[model samples]
Target: MLYFLKHKLVLLATPKTGSTALEQALAPLADMVLQGDPRIKHCTFQRYKWRMEKFIQIFEDEPPQTAALIRHPEDWLGSWFRFRHGSWLNGTTRSTRGLSFDQFVDGYLAEPQPAFAAVGQQARFLTHPKTGETVTHLYRYDAMSEFVAFLGQRLATTITLGRLNVSPEKELRLDPALRSRLEQRYAEDYALYDMALDKHPG
Candidate 1:
């Protein structure tokens, strides 16, 4: 939302891909920052469908440059899970009642719900929403250093990389079985990430 409001760049803030870092870097440059709910990654189609006309009207009044970041599906999910549940450094708590990685994968595969699926989907939509116009830039999280440089050039300001928002030492303790299951669950996301990597080739 900072992208759209300030640089006129609509950034599709993908989850667990160093989005918080990007937001911080851009904070000084932004005209306004609109944060999404911590629970929901982005404004979903279903949620906005009811007010689509009004949303478009609001956009019509805004400037146009937009950008976003995306990451490999498995990596993104791993980071998300770790940040939300496994991060001992940040005092995060593992949920005792939530579905296991395998179960979550099953649900994700059965239904690609935006809220439940990977964050890359949000990045894709930001770049190419159902409304049709492509975003000005679509950045890959793996190439964040370069992307940051690009932003510096565009915004004409220097940016410094900071520590990740949620760093969990406990992530090291995650079972290999669970890790593999999560990776397998986000196989499609891996493919998409590969495609993005290929396109950028940094």
Candidate 2:
């Protein structure tokens, strides 16, 4: 997560949603940056609202506006699977190396997910911890151009996002039946992506 005290904006670093590139790009301009570890980098929106807001209040009088990025549910899951399957995790419990995408989805839906399939629900990450409320300024990762444009306008600066993962994209052929449950689990993720542009109007 990144905080621009001058702009009064708090941008969440949603996992597997191209947050790294944007965070890196904007890091120098941010007044406060929370990153370099999973617990810090992927801090949930609710956690900040309830806990970290006081920390920022010392810097600025106004509560920062919350914003985040959401990738399509299927694509997000696929990225998670592929990310852990990298060579560095060859023999680790978190490795998806030998598993099919379908198998990964099955594991994700299991009651007690395995290390490899334990990625949390996207929508749950952005919801308010106590009230269950969600933010309106969410943007779609697929529509990055529009997102960058929105940010440029809001922050009053130019934003040029570069590709972070240039490796040839792998084919993600998740089973249709398993995909239904995947969608069900991340229903709000779909809703957010669908109406992202509306939430982040020009």
My TM-score estimates for the predictions, one after another, are 0.61, 0.92
Candidate 2 deviant stretches above 4 angstroms: 165-168, 198-200
Put down candidate 2 lDDT per residue, 116-145, tens digits, no spaces: 999998888988857877664788887787
lDDT of each: 0.53, 0.83
RMSD of each: 5.9, 1.8
Candidate 1 local lDDT, residue 59:
54
Which pairs clash inside model 1? 3-9, 4-9, 8-65, 9-65, 9-66, 10-66
TM-score of 2: 0.92
Residue-level lDDT tens digits of model 1 in 87-135: 2424322331254545444444554443433433443443335554444
